[model samples]
Target: MEGPPVKIVALAIQGFVGQVLLDAGGNAKVNKQQFLHQVCKRIHSIGKNLFFEFKEKSFKLHFLMYGSYRVNEEKSR
Candidate 1:
């Protein structure tokens, strides 16, 4: 149980295409809340941490600055 047990934090630049079309100015950036909601919902399908344990364990994830991802896992009690 002391293995690395690696967890991947992947970041997908949502709307990278749309961003190109929208004249920067200030509206090219993605919507943080919207993107977070989308990522959360998608992850929920597989359950947070991709564990899919809806009733047993509560899985949660967060998005970092500038469209970055941060995945963290700890020993489950």
Candidate 2:
């Protein structure tokens, strides 16, 4: 089955938080602050990877077999 429509996706990601978490093997030269206030130009997925593209940077998210995510909802710790 297909996923939700693109318009719904866009509305869900309308803002950006000014933080980035890098992997242990990720590029050391990348400045995480560069993403602050930068607009997300596009969003797409390839295979199991989800990509968020900015003007000068992009990040990819890949979930493990049982990984999951929540949007606009807070989980009590």
TM-score of each: 0.19, 0.55
Q: What is each predicted model's overall lDDT from 0 to 1? A: 0.26, 0.53
- The total number of steric clashes, by the backbone 3 Å criterion, in model 1 comes to 0
**Residue lDDT tens for model 1, 8-56:** 3212322232222211122235433333222222223221232212222
Estimate the TM-score for candidate 2: 0.55
**Candidate 1 Cα errors over 4 Å, as ranges:** 1-42, 45-53, 67-77
Off by over 4 Å in 2: 1-33
User: Per-residue lDDT for 1-77 in model 2, tens only?
Assistant: 12333334434655533333222232336565666567667766565556678777887756546444556455557
Which residue pairs does candidate 2 place in steric collision? none
Best by TM-score: 2
